[model samples]
Target: MAHPALKNAWPIPRRIVQRTRGHGQGFITRLMSPADLGQALKPFVFLDIFDADRAMLQAVERSGGMPIHPHSGVATVTVITQGHARYDDPAIGAGEIAYGGVEWMRAGGGVWHGKEMTAGDVSRMQGFQLWLALPPELENGPAESRYIDAGDMPYAWPAHIIVGKYGDVRSPVPAPDGINYLLVTMRPGESWSYAPPAGHSVGWLALAKGMLDAGSTVSAGEMAIFENGEAPISLEATGSEDAVFVLGSAVPHPHPLHLGHYSVHTSAEALAAGERRIAELGQKLKEAGDRQTASGSVPVFR
Candidate 1:
């Protein structure tokens, strides 16, 4: 009664949690936050889906630049799913982050950044900005960052391993093991299955375009968080257009989240140390006269 590919589906749907849209500073939708679904899907916390079309770009350009900010005790992963984005990081140099490309920054201990990325010349830009909570060890260690081109990332048909291993391929992203993040694209009327690795019970997906039918319908600008289980999940493209989305799964973060003004840590003491380090770094940069730069490149304040 179904296509040949559908017959071998490894995972059936369990449950689907719809996205709760929220306001963003310069984006269309902010899917998850620390209070929303972040607790349920720790290690993978915070997700913002933004559309960088002509109008959005123009608004950003007119508004000038974003201020330098600090983050700690977490790693931020940005993936460009449609069009491209430009970044000039002193640590990783200058490059374009197109589809499948990733910018991973672990704000362990503390660091100041956020003046490096901007919209490229493409007519439209769309992507996901995700934050992962660091483990206790890495959460208080030195900050690190990497800008990996799409070509360097592990490749698989219709799916790019953004965080963890897929099949025999492993992503170059230096992240904690057991977590899996994938960028998947499916053609119209196509069928696909994602068999998550063992112990990865937290599963979720956010679509950028077209429709994905996982028993429940998930359209663009929507995110679907699955129920708690280890069963494989099946996905089908139900729209005429191609389906573009990013899915992530992991064993829930073991530590309790200690929230800060702009950081997340495993404990209160860790948060205090992170905040103190950020303050010291900020002061040092201010005294060195290298805190702000008008160029496109951002100063990596260590």
Candidate 2:
């Protein structure tokens, strides 16, 4: 049975440990960084939310979506909440990435990618790019990538399972165990509550659009981190329009974080190994010459 979304659900609703509107750069907003939130919320590291207009899209098309960049000891997950992204690639063919669609890349040992996605017909494109610190075993393993359309994603009513299980439904994003990421849309005045699974003490939500009453008002672009505990989080859509947000909860990462330009690892040795692999791949990418696809996008390079 579902937990009731009753008004004033808990006398002491899950408290908001902290809230902030993260740093912004042009069309993108940085919600959390490894140096900051990653210490508190491990496995879950960096997050960037972006809104691209026609001008922005044109600029991307000119220079390629994102400059070819290298990542090691991390997995990047891209999900769209509004509009869509177009991709013309050999692996996935041509398609539009709307809400619920995802571009998941596990930059295990090392990988360079940034042109795998392009702007679609939509005038404005909005979504998020999240980075997860990998475990020791997979952190230096093999790299992998996948593009799944919205229709193929797992859905349970108001919740779109992006990376983990929701009730009986599970996402196919190949995420690590002990983490759950969901894109939830709640109708005006609608209430919802999230009951974290066993041992999931890290919980937070970032609003993409509309307002949410999660113990306190969480406006668009704001992120609310819940106090550490097993308590459930109760929320309500306070705005007249639908409220859309991404919520995540996970077990605490057990190791210290070792960071590089675009990587996060468990130990200094792992970080060094990953950096070396990234350097090798970077050299190969340089040798691969003009690696842009006909669609003007660049594929993931390893």
Candidate 3:
């Protein structure tokens, strides 16, 4: 579930007027990528929703799956909604990310992590991993990571401000400016709305579970990119099951996206610099060799 954006042939971006049902790769679904959907929504780039049951979790544990990976020029945000996870970090120490919790890592200059959070004692693990394109200033700066629990997270009614300001609530994460990311849950027949801040013209959300209505039906596993507008995003849970989703808005990124295997930057030179740093870390990671904990899992590397 910690995979990067697929480096497949970049396709001509189809203007997503409203919604899209993205393809699935086993437990993870690729909702948007930097190549297509991301062209219209920058700063807010790639997105994936992962839903794995207990059985799948055990399988991964046995195989030591999801090998360590490198990234730069982007910050990865992982949020859990269904179950929990156990983190074994050398820098931050041990912790747990349960329902509504978040794991944020800014792969500024370069970073290599994937095994930091192993499967926990839960029946299912479900949530999202969003890759936010870093601005010029931070894309090649120092790396940072934060694992915050649900109780400590800032919350407003029906939503958790995952990485930005919401009304009087503001996220603790030092995310770049001009971005607002949120996780929302609504019970059956419940209603909610999101009023974007000025200049935050880019708006979108991927439904995690249950059904929703935003003037149109948005089923589970679907992503909807709202048309450019300043009006509030009116929403409601339509069916018996509760609705949960992650929504984001940002001031459109002004730079042209420069792509790499596990990095994204605003210029070719920046991308090259990030890749070089990743190569250097890959060697160090090799030299460090098998630093897996007694728990039989490896921690993140930078």
Candidate 2 lDDT over residue span 58-134, tens digit each: 88777635677899999999999888887766765777788988988999999988878878877888998999989
* Stretches of model 2 off by over 4 angstroms after superposition: 1-12
Clashes within 3 Å, all models in order: 1, 1, 0
Location of the lowest summed lDDT over 10 successive residues in candidate 3: 7-16
lDDT of 1: 0.85
Higher lDDT: candidate 1 or 3?
3
Q: Model 3 lDDT vs. the true structure?
A: 0.88
Cα lDDT for residue 286, model 3? 92
TM-score of each: 0.92, 0.94, 0.93
lDDT of 3 by residue, 1-302 (tens): 43345533422221236688778987989988899898899988899999999999888877877978999999999998789888877778888998678999999999999988887888899999999999999999999999999999988988998998989889998899889999999999998778888888899989989999887888999999988766678888999899999999999999999999889998999999999999999999999977888765577788
- CA-only RMSD, every prediction: 2.8, 2.9, 9.1
CA lDDT of each candidate? 0.85, 0.88, 0.88
**Pairs with backbone N, CA or C atoms under 3 Å apart (clashes), candidate 3:** none
* Clash list (residue pairs), candidate 1: 11-232
